[model samples]
Target: MQQTKRIAIIAHNNKKNDVLEWAKFNRFFLAQHELYATGTTGKLLEQEIGIPVHKLQSGPLGGDQQIGAKISMQEIDILIFFWDPLEPQPHDPDVKALLRIAVVWNIPIACNRASADFLITSPLMRVEYQPYLPDYQEYLNHNYDQQTTKVRQEQPVSLDTA
Candidate 1:
């Protein structure tokens, strides 16, 4: 239900192609949203896919840091980082740390093509945040508390009640 004003995309060495393919597949959804990406990946997407992408430096060359900063500032909504699971990246720690922050922020993220598809295809992707959605987190937390309290109330009143 959110505007999803901005989204950041990143891809490891081996996954750039995969991300590009997915990007092309979602060009319609992407065109309506602002896009951010690392140097090479952004360039490729812009050149081949014709999508305007705000380019950061190469991930290993401080681009990841830039994206992390945006994430912390709540300037980013969705993040898609296609990681190379098999290869060892020198900047692996930075990637992990950035992902940790995304989790903490409760941002919607798509690490692979499948998840990305689901997210982009969701009916709410381009819709404005409904009144109920804006406070969904708080509502969920309160509901959880009520459910726990109800469980306690329904517990045996006494060991010898019968």
Candidate 2:
């Protein structure tokens, strides 16, 4: 990862203000990085914090999936998502999938203000860091080998009678 990170900030309806407050407090640190957010959150961050953000569709409208795609593509380096656990979300599955993609891609994720603070303040944030990526090719080859063996075993021998 580069010293200047690509950070995605997202917040559920009830947690928007809390995320905004956290963003305002960390404006100095956040300003140096590339910022991205889902619709309303992005607009609010721009209006309240004065930091420019790349806005995507709202979470319910596919923003979480967009962020997940970015993470999978390695375009996003970190995620700060303040999701409301108390309130049920209509798009809960997207939220879970986003978190899963972040982990699968080995990106930094901050689920709340406290964790975001720690993540932003960590010395690692200021340096070029290479995260460990698991080798999926090996896994694919293993699975292919198993499938090929199974297919061969499943095939019945046909004797040709002249």
TM-score of each: 0.77, 0.89
CA lDDT of every candidate: 0.84, 0.94
* Residue-level lDDT tens digits of model 2 in 11-59: 9999999999999998898899999999999999999989899999999
Best by lDDT: 2
How does model 2 score by TM-score? Answer: 0.89
* Residues 52-155 of candidate 1: C-alpha lDDT, one tens digit per residue: 89999999998988998898777888788888889999998889888987876677788889988887787777787542213357878999999999999999
Candidate 2's C-alpha runs over 4 A off are: 144-162
RMSD of 1: 9.5
